[model samples]
Target: MFALYSGSLAEPGDPNPYAGGESLVLPKLWFAGYRRMLRVRIETGPAMQRYRAASRLN
Candidate 1:
């Protein structure tokens, strides 16, 4: 995890070493409600539609 944040895992010659990082520090106020926003997006997103369709077929 430390390696990822520090861009050590990125390819040696790549121009953007930290291109795909998925972790960061947010302000306390922003951090508090971020997950709820993500949860709502996931529940209503196209992936949820695909999941429901597959479950019905099963």
Candidate 2:
């Protein structure tokens, strides 16, 4: 669990990383979220369509 957050933990109650790390969050989460976002965008961003198509076939 600790390793999973490698760098996404929002400290105590904040969702934002430390001050110097603010910029890194977007790119980091981008790559993290981009995996699914990419699969979705491959068919069209917010790719639930692709996911749905696959699910229907299954």
TM-score of each model, paired residue for residue: 0.45, 0.25
List where candidate 2 sits over 4 angstroms from the true fold: 1-22, 39-58
CA lDDT of each candidate? 0.48, 0.46
Candidate 1 lDDT, tens digit per residue, 1-58?
4433334333333343333455343222233344444565678889999999999998
Q: Candidate 1: where is the Cα deviation over 4 Å?
A: 1-29
How much is 30 displaced in model 2, in angstroms? Answer: 1.0
Q: What is the number of residue pairs that collide in model 2? A: 1
lDDT of 2 at 43: 55
Q: Per-residue CA lDDT of candidate 2, range 20-45, in tens? A: 45465554553444354444446564
Clashing pairs in 2: 40-47
TM-score top scorer: 1
Best by lDDT: 1
Per-residue lDDT of 46 in model 2? 50
